[model samples]
Target: MFRKWESPEAVFHLLKACSKGMPCDITGIDDYRMIDEKRGIQWPLPDGHPIEPLSERRLFEDGQFYTPDQRARFVFEAPRPLPEPTTSAYPLTLLTGRGTSSQWHTQTRTGKSYVLRKLHPNVPYVEVSPKDAAELGIRANEWVIVRSQRGQVKARVFVSHVVQPGQVFMPMHDAATNQLTFAAFDPYSRQPSYKACAVRIEPAPVGRSNHSALPALNLFIASLGE
Candidate 1:
């Protein structure tokens, strides 16, 4: 059971076998030994290739290319228009991205650290341009609901000049933020194109709670103070 690929060491051994003849071959690594030694191994260490961790190694030092003609190749394509553009209904471009160094994708592991938790705000907040906030009657730290064709998310108003009048920024750390993202994907790579979506903002009802989608997060933050 321990030898199964589900184990960490077994997975590395399987990876080594899969990369046997590839440029990223990792044959020099041993099971669990690298961790105990606090050492690392650079890949392409193909069974006989000699290199050490942190050492300078160049892939194409011989001035050769992998192309059929042994020369470099470059490709270009015309720029594509945004699939979800801002309209009169959803008049603002909702930009979703990391808010701070302390926050990460979904806050799965970082949210566990008390010190990391304190670095960023516990409540979800949206960065709106001063121009938009004034036009929408949104006050600083006031509860606001952002809506898109897909869904909606509640966030506090953070009026700043960082964003333009036609744009608003929301941190992707909250799972609810995904509900408002555009559900588009690249045809070639199949990678999700969710960075930008058309959404509109309005002042939430006066009695809205601070918590958006994850109430447990507020509880977790409260426990830290005790």
Candidate 2:
């Protein structure tokens, strides 16, 4: 389907048309010059040289690839399971991806805009397998606390058949979710395992901690009253 756009101009025109829903001049050199001026100011300046053209397209032009031979190299990597697991307490393995709507990542900047915030709030949510839901005694749209090795946060529960028996999914837009996630990094990419992680979802606790600190606070308040 995309073979018709072998030319960069055609691809640019297609993107413009898709975004604006109107046909635009794809053959015009002015568009390229405008892009160069506004963004690069060095490329295609009527001098035939793009600001950062692919000056070096091919290497080792001896009609062959590889080092001293045309043999292909193979790369092997061992597979490792995700860090988190579905266990007795964390019976559902939660995976997080992107949200479906218009908000950006974590809704950090987009969340500030009133319009975008109304469309999507900074709320963490968990996807649950039907089997897990039955076992956990929870339902969709209900609040639950997801706890990990790092911390805990409240999120609404969502059920889907797409989720497997031991796996759950979430969108990584809410800070609350981040608080509950580990900050471990991948060996190759140095990226966090945002998708698959161990999580336990239960009914959120209702009361505050009854630690003796509360009595200290109360005593202080009482002394002030005197």
Candidate 3:
């Protein structure tokens, strides 16, 4: 079944003639040919479109919407509390976001290039405010264990004023980063609340003279497999 529709042409044909019907206005092979001719084409470019020689275009120029009233509607709701709140054990809020513009999500594809890797930090590290680091006795570039209710992961501390005293920032590129995030989600969108979680940081235990952070990380991952 998989081999039957492997090629791009076959997939395109199937999309054009699906029983459920195509969501967009992709009619036939000519539409694809038009896409190749023009670098890219916007969606809803049905066959015999009014705008000839389709180039770049925008939708709803006249402020019209796909509604019975032809006007957009806005909805508002009261804010809800975070699923995991900070406690005495886990006092700091862990905020996760993109590390660098050069690195994509998870680093599955963008991590391949040596040049790209050089542009960003090679290893996972958490951003800690100077005030917070000073209180915790954590120095810059020192190994630290970030712990949440879900799990814990070792990361290097980067002392910066960018984060607030009660908040720490970690990039989502690291695999272990998500291990500390709670499975709570928004009720409406159903998107997991990856931004905020309760966490605490402590200095990592000293290792042998020959052991390094990389080897420690490998051991941590191996332990998870068990």
| Residue pairs whose backbone atoms clash in candidate 2 | 43-51, 84-198, 95-170, 96-170
Provide the TM-score for each candidate, comma-separated: 0.76, 0.58, 0.76
In the predicted model 3, the residue pairs found to clash are none
lDDT of 3 by residue, 53-84 (tens): 74555666668776779897776878877788
Give the better candidate number (1 or 2) by lDDT. 1
Full-model lDDT, candidate 2: 0.62
For residues 1-226, could you state the per-residue lDDT of candidate 1 as single tens digits? 4457677778778877788767686776665786467465555577766655568777767666767786766657589988899999999998989877887898999988888876675677788888888899887767889999999888877777778889999889878899998878987658898799999998777663554534444444344335
The lDDT per prediction is 0.77, 0.62, 0.76
- 1 or 3: which has the higher TM-score? 1
Look at candidate 1 and tell me the lDDT of residue 125.
Answer: 74
lDDT of 2 by residue, 68-142 (tens): 476545557698776766577766676777754657778767778887655554455677779988888987666
Q: Cα RMSDs of all predictions? A: 5.0, 15.7, 6.7
Better of 1 and 2 by TM-score: 1
Best by lDDT: 1
Tell how far residue 207 is off in model 3, in angstroms. Answer: 3.4
- Can you tell me which runs of candidate 1 are displaced by over 4 Å? 1-24, 35-38, 52-54, 59-73, 211-226
Candidate 3 RMSD to the correct structure: 6.7
